[model samples]
Target: MLINPTIEQHDEKRRDKMSQVSLTKGYWFFFEHEGNDISMFGSVWNGKENVSFNNEIVSSFRNLNKFKSEHSFSKNGHNYKVCTHMTNMLRGTLVVSLYCDDELLQTETLSQIGKDKPSKRFFSKTFLWFLVFGFAVGMLAGYFNLFG
Candidate 1:
């Protein structure tokens, strides 16, 4: 869905619990645009979708990737929105940020955080530690002649 480009939701029902996540993961912005001026911002990003409006989609070249897009529209008023999305494909976690003239308007992060790299990092670290500990134990046993 083309969510709001900014945080000012005309309806309260549209508000989300992202006042905190936005600080670390995402941001939104809104601004006024007028006549022939190259607006600084207003964007959107959709990774799964190919047809993005008023912007481009950029990939991070990794499964743990980010998507970026942006554009603006206005003849004499604030009439545009832009957003970016960083999503972890392995786990369904999403981070989206929107902007206008460098001003933040709204941000949203999927509450269901995706799986972190715990599996890879955890297993690797544990295995390495185990190997080190085993080596030390074997050396001690050898010195004490306990394994003979």
Candidate 2:
């Protein structure tokens, strides 16, 4: 299986940084099957997903609302499918699999936990808390004004 360096090694600290940078552009998966070069790109923020063979795009679509999506194409009289599954919401983890003729060939996973700072996460939680608090207070004030 042809694998990109960024997608192969997941435990190392340096690879974590590389993954963060790649997220800005999107997640890229490279594979080789039966003498064919296949590449897949999945966006993290948006819902865009694409598949290419020999540098030519074969299938592309946007997936929103659903946690799992699949892309299918045929080469050499065989059907090939690429599936992306979101496994973890908190960690932002996704599992991608490649299948040939309904048989699984390879699998890869991408996560956004690497290089994530605690401060950034804390601020996000704090912001969410304030948003909820403000909403509750607004509701209470409106209720009192109408009742009084």
Point to the candidate with the largest TM-score: 2
- Residue range 30-118, candidate 1, lDDT tens digits: 22223121212112222232222222222222222335544443323444454445455333344545444566655556422325334
TM-score of each: 0.30, 0.63
Per-residue error (Å), model 2, residue 126: 14
What is the Cα-based TM-score of model 2?
Answer: 0.63
Q: lDDT of model 2 at residue 119?
A: 44
State how far residue 102 of model 1 sits from its true place (Å). 3.0
lDDT for every model?
A: 0.38, 0.71
Error of 2 at 2 (Å): 22
TM-score of 1: 0.30
Superposed on all Cα atoms, model 1 deviates from the true structure by an RMSD in Å of 14.9
